[model samples]
Every structure is written in C-alpha cells, then in structure tokens.
Target chain A: MIRYVIRRLLLAIPTLLAMLTMVFVLVRLVPGDAAVSMLGDQASEQALDALRARLGLDQPIHVQYLTFLGDMLRGDFGTSMSSGRSVLSEVWQVLPYTLELTAAAMVIGVLFGLPLGTFAALYRNRWPDYTTRLLSLTGLSFPGFVSGILMLLAFAVWLRWLPVMSSASSDPLTHMRNLALPALNLGLIMTAYITRVTRSSMLNVLGEDFIRTARAKGVRPGPLVMRHALRNALIPIVTVVGLYFGTLIGNSVLTEIVFTRPGLGKLILGALQSRDYTLLQGLMVIFAAFVILVNLLTDLIYAAVDPRVSYAK
Target chain B: MTPVLDIKGLTTEFRVKNGWHAAVRGIDLSVNANETLAVVGESGSGKSVTALSTLRLLPQTGARISRGEVGFGGRDLTKLSEREMSRIRGNDIAMIFQEPMTSLNPTMTVGDQIAEGLLIHRGMSRTEAAKEARRLLDEVRVPDPARRVNDYPHQFSGGMRQRAMIAIALACRPKLLLADEPTTALDVTVQAQVLSLLDDLKRDRGMAIVFITHNLGVVAQIADRVAVMYAGEIVETATCDTLFADPVHPYTEALLKAMPRVDRKAESLEPIPGSVPSISARPAGCVYAPRCNYVQPSCAAHPSLVPVGGNHEARCPVRADKGEAA
Candidate 1:
C-alpha cells in the first residue's frame, strides 16, 4: 500500500506540471502586462521599457518560461511587480492566517456535521432525520457572502458579542476570533454537504444484512454504530472531507475578501487589483501545491480508516 | 408434559396504507423436550415470520403481533419488553438464521460472535469466553479450533460459517434452538454435514429444536414431527413416519406426489397444479383450493385443522370423511 502511494505521488508530478503549464499560459494571456504595470501609467514610456527589460520581460515567452523554471528549481519566485518585494516572502507572510481559518472551519464543520448525520441516519424517517435534513437545506440555500453578512449582522450588530471583521495582527487568537464567523459561514455549507454524505452512507451500511447479524448476536447499539456502521460510513465521509480540505486552501479567494483577513485570499485579491503578475502566478502555484499535498494526506488518512481502499496504478 | 416452547394463536399482521394484512394468522405449534419440529414452507410462506415473531424481532414500525402467546419455560416471551427479550434471546431460546454467511458479522472473528452469548448472558470474561468459544468450535467439529478462533467470518468457508453459527447457538446450552434452514445455504455435501452436526448436537444436549426449512428431504431426516405451512397457516401436522407414509391433506398429498422418488417414480414427477398462494394476496376461502386436487364445494370456505388419526391432523374437511377421493 505504501509503495502504491509512493508511485501515485511520483505520477502526480506530470499532472501537476500539466496544470502549471495551463495556469501559466492562461494568466499570461489575460491582457495585463506585469512589467509595464509595475512602472504604473504615471511613469514615462522609457522607464516602463527599462523595467520590462530589467525583469526579463523583453524576452520571448518560451525564454521567460525557461528562466522562470530554472529560478523556480533553485527556489526563487522572483520579486512582486506591484510591491517590489519577493513573491515568496509575501506568500509566507499571509499563508499562516489562511491555514488557521481553514483549520478552524474544518474542525467546526466536522464537529457539527458528523454526529448530526449519524443520528439522522440512525433514526431515519423520524423527527431527528427531518430536522437535520431541514437544517442542511437551509444551510446550503444561502450563498457564502450573504451568510457571512447575516452572521456579522446578528453577532456584531444586534448581539454585539464580537468583531465582525478580521485584520492582520501579531496575536493569532484575536485574529482567529475575528475570522471565526466567515470561516463558520463557509463551514456551515460544508457541514451541510458532509452531513448528507455521512447520513446516506451510514444508512446504507446499517441496512446491510451484517448489521442485523450484529444486533442478532446481542451486540449493543452504541458499539454497533461505532464499530460497524460509522467505520464504514467514514469511507465516503473521508472522500468528502478530503475534497473539502483541498477546497479550503482555495477558500481564501472569496472567504478572505468577506472577512478581510490578511491571508492568501486577500493576497491573491491584492495582487489581482494591483496587477502584480509574478505575485499572482506564485500564489496560484502555492495554492495548487498546498491543495495537492492536503489531498495526498487525506488519501493516506482514508486508507487508515478503511484498509480495503488503496491507490490504484 | 409441559412443552419446552409453545406458540398459541399467533397472529402477526402488517399495516399497509389501506389496512392491516395478516402475515401469520393464528398458527399454533408446540415443541416438547428434546423433540425436533420441522416447520416447512416456500418463500414468503410466513415460515421466517413465525420464527422471528417468537422473539418479537419482527420490524415493529409496520409490523404488529395482533395476538399471540409464545410460552417458553412457563413465561410468555411475547409479553416481554425489548430489554427482557434481549436478555432472553441467545440465553433461553437461541436462533441461527438461514444465511450463515450474512448471519455472522464479517469484521468480527468467528470466536467473538460465538462467545458473544456467553459474554452477554453468562457474564464470562473475554479470556474465559475465548477459551470456551474455542472449545465450542472444536465440539462443533471445526478444524483447528484454537488457532482459527481469531479468524474472521471471511476466513471460514460456507460450511465452516454454519458450524460457527451452530457453535454460537449452542454456547449457553439454550433449551430450544430455532434454525431457519441452517443448511439451505450450503452445497449438498456440506448440507449433509451441517444436518448431521445439528442432529448430533440435539441428541448430545437434549435441547429441543424448531427447524424451519423448505426441503422435505431435510425434514424426513432430522424432524421427529413435521408441520406443513401454506399461506401463513399450518395446514397439516403429523409424525415423520405417518406424514411421509400416509399423508391425508390434499396439500400434503400433493407435496408427497411432487416428491421426485428415484425408486418409485415412472413418468416425469408431477408438480402441485398451481402456485402457492401469495401472502399479500391470499384467497378469500381456502388458500390452497386453487392448487388442491380434491377441492370440494365446501372448500370455498377455508377449512380449520381437524384431527384425523393418532398424533396426526390436516386442515381439510374432505380428508376427515371422504378419504383420498378427488
């Protein structure tokens, strides 16, 4: 099994390379000139051209790609066209906050979703099942931004319990508290999805003839759910959680803008607005890598949960 | 003598959208000490429903036992609470289902399932139960009982799984064991092995057994008495010798004639003329009238079981007076 995963990871290199090529070409073709934009319109024509030449923008696209690839292999992402700072430094500066938000939201989602789903599945066609089904419907119906605004209004405006927005701060705890609402907004929707998956998977497993056999053998309900039903249900839940975790890395795009947290999402937005081409490319690359890595870890964790699954050739 | 287990006027019905439909209608049966009573019927003939109703294990949401008294050891099991019933199950009256492949948990080791009753009812420690389970496994003639006890259900073949189930049923020395076609899932050779094991276990422990199966051949071998059930009702009951030798009910006679006897048959064996009545769509009058060769005008109304001879009876009015005339 370990050998299989190692091989899969090795094979992912080409897949990642193909994605990198597509993203690189797509971003470059999109109309903004990173080198010219770096000098801004206020600068003279001469100054823009000089900056372009200095940044290797005067070269053909192929030449630029090779140089970028060489530099990337040697661990250099180049300086940001907008901020005139290292692209790598800016990414590292904002990544931790994004990680914190994603982590917090995921924990919240799992905490809320798994039990509700299990109970709903256990008492299917009953009151608890209907209640969860209703709650999930409500959760998924609202868009993230709207949900974020409403949470802000309820907690910050009426209740006046906590701050509605997040700012970059040295103290991560305060930053986390401010970030919680938007994170939970994203989490609520994910919880709805994961719960439905858990309920269906668990319900199917519980209906198997083996489950009745367990009950017949006098195994109690609690252990039967945990040992038999839940373990099997987790296979699908694992896949959903893994996909959600990968998506969380990308959540920084909209989620950060809503919460105004100084994270990768905000970084990407700033890069886009200022037209920092190098920084944008670097951030996209990092996000892709993080998602790929997180998904790999999730796959490994899923294997641990259910031994029957192994990465195929 | 008091019956080891007695089921009287047992009626189970399902609540459909329109109304209640009787699944098992007022069937009466009794098992005496060390006696084997084979309940025989085809699928949906309420054979399994009767077995499950004894423990009140029927799906309770849509299913309700309209009336019944399942008296075992002088206590009516039907009157017991879920908690009390759980305590009784695997303790006093154990049951083994038809599909041993599914009746045992796949993820759990066979020994754990076998020892489960001991742990639940006997309060046996895990270590003690494991040892006892191995011994039971060996007693059931399972190969390499000590080592194989740690193996899961998947490790055992079909025959071995049935043996493991038998080991579990016999764990607490239950007074009565309800086997719902224990050999039905096995190949012919394995079927014979399981049947002999059941016979040996019954003789050795003196435990009364209520064996439910569709195969009359199996009934002839192990059953001391046979009850033929049709459309949720027992239409005939007789000692094994008399049941196979001088069957009286038209349904019983039809079944006897349907039997493919290698020694006695000349032409192709005759099948019962019509299909067994559907449980959901039972006939208004006689359930088997559509299939009976001797359907009299009176058979338009369902006939109640009437005694015909010593320790033998059939649910046919014509058999009591008209003999075997069609």
Candidate 2:
C-alpha cells in the first residue's frame, strides 16, 4: 500500500506539470494584457513597459514558462500582480473556506443521499422510490448557482432562517450559519448525483445472488441491506462521490459567486478578472492537485470499503 | 417419524405485465429427518421457486406465496409473521443457492459470512463466532481455515466458495437445509465432492435436506426420495430407486430418456422435445400435453396426482389407466 501510494504520487508529477502548462497558456490567451490591467488605462506606454519588464512579462513566452515551472518546482508561486502578495499566501487564506464548503456538501450529500438511494432501491417501484427519483431529477435539472440563489432567497431573504451571505466572523458557529445556505445549495445538487448513482448501484447489488444468499442465511433486513447489499453497492457510489468531490472543488465558483462567499472560486474569479496571471496559474495548479488528491483518497476509500479491492493488487 | 418440513398446497405467484401468474402451483412435499428429498426438474419447472417458497425467500415485490402452509417443527411457516419467519430462516431452516461463484458476499470474508448466522441465531459473541466460523470452515474442509477465515470470497475457488456457503447454512445446525441447485455452478469432480460433503454432513447432523436440482445424475447420487416437477407442479414422486427404475409420468420418462449414458455409445444424446411452458402462457389442460408423445384427446383436463403403489404417485391419467389395465 505504501508503494502504491508512492507510485501514485510520483505519477501525479507529470499530470500536474501538464495541467500547469495548460493553465499558463490558457490564462495568457485571455484577451487582455496583465501589465495593462495592473497599471490601468491612464498609464503611459513607458510606464506599462517598465511594469511589464519589472514583472518579467516582457520575456519570451517560453522563457516565462520555464521561470514559472522552475519557481513552482522550488515551491514558490510568484506574487499576485494586483495585491503584491505571494499567490500561495492568498490561496492558503481562502483554501479552508473551499475545503469547508466541499466537505459540508459532501457530508450532507452522503448522509441524506446514501440512505435515500438505498430506500429507493429497497422499496423500488413504491411511493418512496418514485419520490426520490423525482426529487433527484428536479435537483439535477437546476444549475448550482440558480439553486444557491433560490436557497438564499428562501432561507435568508424570506424565512430569515440563515444569513444572506457569509460573514467575516472567526466564530465557528456564526461562520457555519452563514455558510449553511450555500453549502446546502451545493449539497442538494450533490445529493441528487449521489442518490442517482447510489440507487442504480444499489439496484445492481441487491439483484446479485449474494444478497439472496445473505437473506437465505436469515440476515435481518437492516444488517443484510447495509452489510451485504450496501457494502458491495458502495464501489460505484464512491466513484461518483469522488468524481463529484473533485468537481465540487472547482465548480464552487458559481455557488461562491452567488453567495458572495470568500473561497477559492471567488479568489480565482478575482484573479481572472484582474488578469492576475501568477495567482490564476497557482490556483489552477492547486485545483489540479486537489483533484489528484481526491482521486487518491477515493481509491483508498475503495480499499477501505471492500476487502477484495486493494491498491497493491 | 414426523417430517422436519411439510409443505402442503403451496402456490407461488409472480406479478407480470398483465397480472399475477402462478409460478408454483399447489404442491405437497415433505422432507423427513436425515433424508435428502431431491426436487428434480428442467429449468423453469418451479423447482427453485418451490425451494424459495418454502423459505419465503421469493422476491418480495413481484413474487409471493399466494396460498400455502409450510409446516416445519409443528408450526406453519406461511402463517408466521415477518419477524417470526426471520427467526426461523437461517436458524431452524437454512438455504444455500445455486451459483457458488456469486452466492457468497463478495465484500465479506468467508468466515464472517459463515459466522453471521451464529451471531444472529446462536447469539455467540464476536470472538466465539469467529472461532466457530473457523471451525465451520475447517468442517467444510477449506484448507488453512485459520488463515482463510480472513480471506474475502474472491480469494476462494468456486468449490471452496460453495463449501463456505454450506458452512454458513449449517452454522446454526438447522434442522432442515434447502439447497437450490447448489452444485450446478461447479464442475463434475467438485460437484461430486460437494454432494458427498453434504451427504456426510446430513448423516453426521441428521438434518433433513430438500435438494433442488436439474441434474438427474446429482439426484441419483444424493437423493433418498425424488420429486419430479414440470410446469409449476410435481408430475411424479417416488423413492429414489423406484423413481429411477420406473418413471411413470411421460415428462419423467422423457427426462430419463434425455440423460446421456456412458455405458452405451449412442449416436447422440436425446433431448426432451419441447421446453417447459412459460408461467404466464400455460395451457389450460395438462401442461405436458402439448409436448407428450402419448398426448390424447382425453388428456385435455389437468390430472391430479394418483397413487401408483408403494409410496409412488404420478399425475397422468393415461399412464394410470394403462397401469391398471396391465
């Protein structure tokens, strides 16, 4: 298992490098000059030239790419053009919020979706099954931002149950309250995905002969479903959850924007708008790293859930 | 001696696109202590359904026991509540299914699978159950039982998995074991080994067994008595020796004729001419009438079972009349 993890981590190097190259090129391709954006429209040509040279933006694209790669290798993401702060420090500041949102969404999704899906499968063709299917279908059809807005309106504006936006408070309880609507909005969307995958996977597992064998062995309904059916059913559900978790990390952009929360999505959006090349590139690499990390965690979870599945194997 | 299991007029139905269709017609069968009663038939002849019905393990949503009384240990199993039935299942009455490759839970260790029944019914502590599980594995003759107990199902071979399944079924020392074609998934050598293992276990424990199978050869090897099912009903039933020597029903005769014998070098093995009728599309008259060579105009009505002497019975009017005339 150690060897397997080490191999995976080693393999991620090339993948991250590729991701970093693509982000570097793509951010540069955006129709604006970073130096011009930094100095604003009133800046003289000579001033723009000086700023460009100072930021090393005047160098050839290949040379700049090499410098970026070298710095990244040396564990340095250059300072943000707008804030004059290290890109890493800026990412670190907002990293927790994004992690918190994704984690909350994931927890909510699994807690509700897993059982709902299991219930749907167990009582297939019944009212509960139909209700879950319909609910998930509705959830799937709505975009995350739209749902976030709807939740904001319903809970914060209308019901006054939750705060309208995330507050700049350090208190965990108050912070949680502020994040509730956005987290729930994203969570509901994730729940839909989890429910659909869980139901189908559960249906497949429940139909398996092992489940019948378990039943024949006089395994009661609760343990039989959970230990026998659900355990086997979890592989596909885990795959879906893991893939969605990676998506949740990057896809929180719209939800964060709608909720006006200070997170990676908002951070990256700011970088993109201000043509903060260093920060944008750094955040993209971080996102890539996160996706790779999530995939690794998912694989580990698979091994945990099923004894037959092994990273070494 | 009183039977361990007495199933009377058991009818099972599956809801189809149109309506409920009976998969197992009202059939009476019983298994006495320490005896192996083999319910033999071709596929779709309700043999598996009969076994499933006995345990009330039929698919809950689409299939159901429409009418029946499964009397086991002086209690009506059909009349038992879900909770009561659960208590009986895997405790007093255990079942092992066909498809050894898939019967055991893939994610679980074979030991835990075997120990599950012990834990639930025997109320054994986890450590005790684990030890018993190892012992059960050893009894089933799985090599390195102590180490293999921690191994998942995928690690075990098909035959070993089947043995583990048997260990699970026998873990609680159930009085009756329902084996639904348990050896069908295995090759001939493994099949023989499993059959003998089951026979030995039955002998040692004196437990009744209702072995459901499609293979006549398996029935001949392990069965004390035989019940031949066709089209959702038992067409003939007799002591194993008697049934093999003189199969009275035409379906039974056809089935016996279809067997490939090594002693005779025949051009080709004979197969029964027609397939078993579909449950939903069953004929009004005798189920085998459409396929029987001796089908007659008088064979238009379904015939009830008739005594053919010495604990043998057949559900065929023409055969019964011919026997009487002779």
Candidate 3:
C-alpha cells in the first residue's frame, strides 16, 4: 500500500507540471495586457513599459515560461502584482476557507444523502422514495449561483437573520455565522449528487445475495441497510463524494461571490481580473494537487471498504 | 411429536405483469427435530421460494407468501409481526443459501459474519461472540480456525466458504436450518464433504434441516425423508430408501432415471423430456401432467397427496392406485 501510494504521488508530478505549464500559457493568452490592467489603460506608455519590465511581462513567452518553471521548482510563486504579497502565502491564507466550505458541504451531503438514499431504496417506489427523488432532482436542476442568490435573498434580505455581506471576523460564532450561508449553498448542491449516487448504488447492493444472507441472519432493518447494504454500496458513493469535493473547491467561487466572502475563490478571481499571472498559476497548482489528492484518497477508501480490492498487486 | 417447523398450505407468489402468480402452490410439509427433509426439484420448482417463505425472507415488494401458516413453537409465524418474526429468524430458524461464493458478505471477515447472529440474538458480548465465532469455524473444520476466522470470504475456496456459511447459520444453534441447495455450487468431492458435515451437524445439534436441492444423489446420501417437487408441488414423498427404490409418481421415477451412474453408459441418461412449467402458465389440473409419462385422462384435475403405502405418499391418482394394486 505504501508503495502504491508512493507510485501514485510520483505519477502526479508530470500531471502537476502539465497543469502549471497550461496555466502559464493560458493566462498569457487571455486578451488583455497585464501591465495595462494593473496600471490603468490611460497610464503613460513608458510607465506601463517600466511596470511590464518589473513584472517580467516584457520577456519573451518561452523565456518567461522557463523562468516560471524554474521558480516553481524552487518553491517560489512570485509576489502577487496587486497585493505585492508572496503568491504562495496569499493562497495559503485563503486555502482553509475553501477547505472549510468543501468539508462542511461534504458533511451535509453524506449526513443527508446516505439516510435519504437508504430510505428510498427500502421503501422503493413508495412516497418516501418519490419525495426524495423529486427533491434530489430539484436540487440538481438549480444552479449553484442561483440557489446561493436565493438563499442570500431569503435569509439576509427578508429574514434579516444573517448579514447581506460576509466579513473575516475572528470570533468563532461570528465566523461560523459568516460561513453558514455559503456553506449551505454549496452543501445542497452536493447533497443532490450524493443522494442520486447513493440511491442507485444502494439499490444495486440490496439485491445481492449477501443482502439475503444478512436478512436471513435476522439483522434488523436498520443495521441491514446501514451496515450490510450501505457498506457495500460505499465505493460508488465515495467516488461521487471525492469527485464532488474537488468540484466544491471550484464551485465555492459563486457562493463566495454571492456572500462576498474572502476565500481562494475570491483570491483567484482577483488574480484573474488584474492578470496576476503568479497568483493564478499558483492557485491552479493548488487546484491540480487537490484533485490528485482526492483521487488518491478515493482509491484508498475503495480498498478500505471492499476487501476484494487488493492493492498488493 | 410436534415438528420443529410445520408449514401448511403455503402459497408463495411473485408479481408478474398481470398480477400475482403462484410460484409455490398449497405446499404442506413438516420437519421433526433431528430429521433431514430434502425437497428435491428441478429449477423453477419453487424450492428456494418455499425456504425463503418459511423464514419470511422473501423480497419485500415483488414477492410474498399470499397464503400460509408456518407453525413453530406454538406460534403461527405467518401471523406474527415482522418485529416478532425477526426474533425467531436466525435464532430459532436459520438459513444458508446456494451460491456460497456470493452468500457471505465480502466486506466482513468470516468470523464477524458468523458472530453477527450471536451478537444479534444471543446477546453475547463482542469478545464472547468473537470467541464463539472462532469455535464455529473450528466446528465447521475450517483449517487454522484462529487465523482463517479473520480472513474475508474471498480468501476462502468454494467448499470452505460454504462451511463458513454453515457456521454462520449454526452460530445461534437454530432448531431449524433451511439450507437451500447448500452443496449445489460445490465440486462433487466437496459436495460429499459438505453433505456429511451437514449430516454430522444435524446429529450433534439435533436440529431439523430442510435441505433444498435438485441432486437426488445428495438426497440419497444425507436426507432422512425426501419430497420430490415438480412444478411447485410435491409429487411424491417417502423415506430416502423408499424414494430410491419404489418411487410412485411418474415425475419421481423420471427424476431417478435421469440420475447419472457409473454403472450406466452416459448415453443411457435420459433428460426429463420437457421443462418445468412456468408459474404463470401452469395447467389447471395437474402441474406435471404435460411432463409425466404415466399421465392419464383423469390427470385433468389436481391430485392431492394421498397415502400410497406404509410411510409413503404420492400426489398422483393413477400412480397411487397402481402402487396399491401391485
């Protein structure tokens, strides 16, 4: 298992490099001049040229690309053009917020999705099943931003229970309060995908011979579904959850925007608007690493849940 | 003596496109303590359904025991609430199914699967149950019981896994063990070993067994009494010896004739001419009339199981009279 993990980690290097290279090229390809965007279009040509030279934008594409690769290899993601803070440190500060959002959303998804799916499979074609299916369908159909906005309007504008805009408060309760709306916005979307995956996977496992053995062993309905059926159904559910975890990282952008919260999403957005090549590339690297990490975790969880899956090979 | 399990007029049905169709129709059988009753049948004969119905383990939606009284321990199991029935299942009445490869949970260790019933019904502590599970593994003759107990089902061979399944069913020491073709999926040598193991377990535990299978050779070896089922109905039931010697029903005789033997040429084996009738398309009168060689004009009506001779019953009017006349 250790060897397998090491191999997977080794294989990710090329993937990370490719993503970094792509971000390096693609950010430059966008139709905007980084120096002009930073120094306003009305700035003097000489001043813009000086800013471009300072930002390393005046160099040829290949030279800049090679320099970026060299700096990345040395663990230096240059300072953000707008903030003048180290890109790595800036991303590090906001990474936790995105992680918090994804983790909270995932907790909500599993908490609600597993029970709802098990209930649907058990009742199968009855009202509970139909209701859950309908709820999941509605949840899936609504876009993350639209739901995020609806929630903002409902809780902040009308109810006045929450603030219209979020702030980086130090108080735990206030921080939690600030996090709730955006977390819930992404959480509901995740719940939809998880519920759908869990329901179908559970339906398949419930028909297996082992399920019959469980029943014949006189296992109670509750444990039968949760332990015998759901445990077997977990591989697919975990796959969906891990895939969505990576998605939630990217998806937090809209929720962050709706709530005006500070996070990696906001950081990346600012970098894009101001054409901060260093910060954008750094954020892409983080995103790629997260995707690889989640995939690896998903495979490990598969081995944990299923005994037949041997990583020894 | 009161039988450990008495199933009367048990009719299990499955939902077809039109409506409910009787897969097992008006079946009555009983197993006394320490007796092995083999219900032999071809595929689709509703043998497995009968076992599932007795435990109320049939699928919740598509299938149900439409009519029946499963009498056990002075209680009508069919009338008991699901909550009450669950107490009896795996405690007083346990079951092991065919397809041992898939019957055990892949995610659970062999010991945990066996210990589950002990924990659930016996109220044994986890450690105590673990100990008992190890003992069960030993009882089933699984090698290195201490180590093998922790291995998952996939690690065990087909015979070994079936032994584990038996250990799981026998964990709670149920009075009635419904083994649905327990040996059907094993090798011929493994089949004999499993059969004798079951026979020995039955003797040691004095638990009644309702063994469902298509193999008469297995029945002759392990069954105390045999019921020949054709198209969801018992065509003949007799002592294992009588069943092999003077089978009264045409279906029973045909089934015996089809058995392959070392003494007979492979060409001499006669496959039963036609298949068992589908539940939905069963003939109104006799279920096996179309497939019976001794089928008579009077076979247009269903025949109830009637005594043919001492300790023997056959469900064919023509054959019953012929046996008596002889």
Candidate 4:
C-alpha cells in the first residue's frame, strides 16, 4: 500500500508539471501587463521602463519562463507585484483559513447528510423521506454565494448572531463563530449532494442478499442498517464525498468573497485584480496540488473500506 | 412426534399496477424433525415465496403475506412481534439464500458473518465466537480455516461461499433451516458437494430442512418428502420415491419428464409445454389447468388437495379419479 501510494505520487509529477506550465502561460496571456497594473496609468515612460526591468518583463520570454521554473524549483514563487511580499509566504498566510473552511464544511456535510440519507432510505416513500428530499432539493438549487449572502444577511445583519465580516480573532470561540456562517453556506450544498448519493446507494444496498442474510441471522434493525447496509453502501458515499471536496474547494472562493474572509480565495482574487501574475500562478499550483492529493486520498480510502480493493498489483 | 414446522393457508401477495396479486396462494406444508421437505417448482412458482413468508422475510413494500399461520415451536410465527420474530429467526430457525456470490456480505469477513450468529443468539464472547467461527468453517470443510477465516466472501470460490453461508446458518444450531436454492448458482460438481454437505449436516444435527428448489435431482438427493408447487399452490405432495414413481398431478408428471437424466437420451429431454401463468392473470379454476396435460371439464372448478393413497395427496380432481380407478 505504501509503495502504491509512492508510485501514485511519482506519477503525479507530469500532471503537476503540465498544470504549472498552463498557469505560467495563461497568467502571461491575459490582457494587461503586471507592471502596468502595479503602477498607475499616469506613470512616466522611464519609470515604467525601470519597473519593467525590475519585474523581468524586459527579458526574453523564454528566459523569463526558464527563470520562473528555476525559481519555482528552488521554492521561490517570486514577489507579489502589488504587496511586494513573497508569493509563497502570502499563500502560507491564507492557506489555513481556506483549509479550515473546507474541512469544516465537509464535517458538517457528512454529519447531517449521512443520517438524513439513511433516514430517507429507511422510511422510503414516507413523509420523512419526502420532507428530507424536499430539503435537499432546496439545498441543491441554491448557489454558494446566494446562500452565503443570504446567511450573512440573516445571521449577521438580521439576527446579529454572527459577525458580518470574518474576524481574525485570537479567541477560539470568536474564530469558530466567524467560520460558522460561510462553512454552512458551502456545507449545505455538500450535504444536499451527499444525501442524494447516500440515499440511492443505501437503497441499492438494502436490497442486497446480504441484508436478508443479516436479517435471517436476527441482526436487529440498528446494526442491520448501520453495519450491514451502510458498510456496503460506503464506497459510493465516500467517492461522492471525496469528489465533492474538490467542488467545495472551488465553491469556497465564492463563499469566502461573500463572507469577507481572508483566505486563498480572497488572496487569489486580489492577485488577479492587480494582475499579480506570480502570485496567481503560485495559487493555481497549490490548487492543482490539492486536487491531486484529494484523488490519492480517495483511492487510499477505497482500499481501506473495501477489502476486495487489492493494492498488491 | 410433533412436526418442527406446520404452515397452513399461507398466501403471499404482491402489489401490482391493478391491485394486489397472490403469488403464493393457500399452500400447506410441514416438516418433521430429522427430515428434509423439498419444495420443488419452476421459477415464479412461489416456492421461494413460501420460504420467505415462513420466515417473514418478505420485503415490506409491495409484498406481504396476506394470510397465513406459520406454526413453529407451538407459536404462530405470523402473529409474533418483530422483536419476538427476530429472536426466533436465527435462534430457533435459520435461513440460507440462493446466489452464493451475492448472499454473503462482501465487505465483511466470512468468519465475522458466522460469528455474528454466535454472538447474537449464542451469547458467546467475542473470542469464543471467533474460535467457534473457525470451528464452523472447518466443519463446512473450508481448507486452512484458521487463516482463511479472516478472508472476505470475494476471496472464496462460489462453492466455498455457500459453505460459509451454511456455516453461518448452522452457527446457532437451530431446529430448522430454510435453504432457498442454495446450490443453484454453483457448478454441477460444486452443487453435488454442497448437497452432500447439507445432507450430512442435517443428519448429524437432526434439523428439519425446507429446501426450496426446482431441481428434481436435488429433491431426490436431499428430500425425504417432496411438495410440487405450480402457480403459487401445491399441486402434489408425496414421499420422494412415490412422487418420482407415481406422480398424481399432470404438472408433476411433466416436470419429471422434463428433467435431463443420465439414463435418458439428450433428445428425449421434454420441456414443459407453456410457462406458469402470471400472478395477476391466473385463472380462477385449477391454477395449472391451462398448462396441464390432463385437462378435463371438472378442472374448470378449483380443485382441492385431496388424499389419493397413503401419505400421497394431489390437487387435481381428474387425476384423483384416475388414481382411484387404478
């Protein structure tokens, strides 16, 4: 298993290289020069020339690309043109906020979604099932920003239960209070998807012969559903959760903007506005790395949950 | 001696677009201690339904035992609460299903499945159940059971998986085992092996079996008595030898002729002329009358199961007259 994981990590090298190349090319290809955007439009031509030289824009394109790759290989992501801070350091500063938001959203998704799904499946075609289906449908229909903004209005402005802006407070309670609204905004969407997947998977598993076998063995309803049915249904559930984790990462950008949280999403948006090419490219690399890592984790989890998933090959 | 199980007026129904339809209608069956009663029929003949109804294992949606009294251990199982029924299920009565490939839980170890019954019904400690699970595996003749006990169902061959299922059913050492075509999904050679294993286990344990299958050959091997079912009703019941020697129902006669046998030529194999009637569209008269070879004017009226001779009964008025004349 360890060897398999190592091999998978090794195979990701080409993918990472490709993603980096795309970020490098695409960031440069966008309209506006990084130096021009960093300085005011009224700046003198000589001042612009000096800034371009300092920014390496005056160098040959191939030379600049090689320099960019070399610096990346040596763990230097260049300086943000707007803030003049190292791009890697800036990314590190905001990484935790993004990680915590996504993680919290996932936790909430699993916590509520699994039970709601199981409840729906168990009481299938009944009122409870219908009610949950309707609730999940509503959750699915709303986009992250719409929900995030609405929650901000309802909880922060209307109710005054939460802060309008996410505060970088030292108090743990204040920190969590700041996280609650945005996390839920993304989490509710995750829940809706998870609930649907789990319900269908559970419905399918409940009909299996093994469930009948367990019943014939006098396994009570609780363990029969939890142990027998849920364990068998877990492959699809875990897959959906893992797949949606990537989607949540993407959705977190909109959610962070609405919640006014200082995160990778906010940093990347700032970099994009100022045409901070190096900073934007660095963030893209991290996002691509996250996608690769999540896929690996999903595969590893499949092996853990299902004994039939052999890693020997 | 009192019988182990006596089922009467067992009618199971399934909901369809039009209305509820009887799948297994008013069938009577009994199994004595130390005996095997094979419920033999073609697909959709309700043989499997009878077994499921007895255990109350039918799906809650779309299917129900509309009326029946499953009398086991001096109590009507049909009337028992779900909790009470569960106590009897794997404790006093156990069941193994068809499809060995899908019958056992794939995610769990074979040993865990066997040990589950031991843990729940037998109240054995975890360690004790684990040890006993290995013993049960050995009993079923799973090789290297000490190591293989930890293996999952997918790791085992189809035959081995069925054996593991048997090991689980026998874990609680119940008085009855409802084996619903337990060998159907296996190869012919594996089928023979599982048959012998079940027979040996039945004899040693003195447990009565309700073996549900369509294979007459399997009936001959495992059954002391056989009940022939057609269109959700028992058309005939007799001792295994008697049923094969002198089948009183036309349906039973055709079934025997249809079976492929080593002594019979390949070309001589007869297929029953038409399929069993659909549950919803069944005729009010004798259920098998349309497909039956011995169609008489009297067959328009539903025939009751009546005794023809000693321990032999058939549900055909016309054939019952023939038996009397002979």
Per-residue lDDT tens digits for candidate 2, residues B1-326, read 99999999999999989599999999999999999999999889999998888888888888989898989999988888888888988999999988888888888888898899998999999999999999999998999999999999999999999999999999999999999999999989999999999999999999999999989999999999999999999999999998888878999988888887787656566777878889999999889998998998878988899988879899998897654443
Q: What's the lDDT for candidate 4?
A: 0.91
User: Number of the top candidate by DockQ?
Assistant: 4
* TM-score: the better of candidates 1 and 3: 3
Docking class of 4: high
Candidate 4 chain B: worst 10 consecutive residues by lDDT? B317-326
lDDT of each residue in B184-226, candidate 3, tens digit only: 8999999998999999999998999999999988998999999
Candidate 4 residue-wise lDDT, A1-313, digit = tens: 8799999999998988888788889988899866677788888889999999998999998998889888876878888888889988999998999999999988889999999999999999999999999999999998889988899899999999999999588899999999999999989998898898889999999999899999999999999998899988999999878877778899999899999998998997898888888788888888888999998899999998999998877
| Model 2, CA-based lDDT | 0.89
- The digit string of per-residue lDDT tens for model 1 on B132-171 reads 9999999989999999899888788999998998898889
Q: Considering only the true interface residues, what is the Cα RMSD of candidate 1 after superposition? A: 2.5
Candidate 3 Cα misplacement greater than 4 A, ranges? A310-313
Task: Identify the leading candidate in terms of lDDT.
Answer: 4
The pairs that clash in candidate 2 are none
Model 3 TM-score is 0.96
Task: Give the CA lDDT, 0 to 100, for residue B250 in model 1.
Answer: 82
DockQ of all candidates, in order? 0.40, 0.82, 0.80, 0.89
- Judge candidate 4 at residue A302 and give its lDDT: 96
Candidate 4 per-residue lDDT, tens place, B151-253, comes to 9999999999999999999999999999999999999999999999999999999999999999999999989999999999999999999999998899999
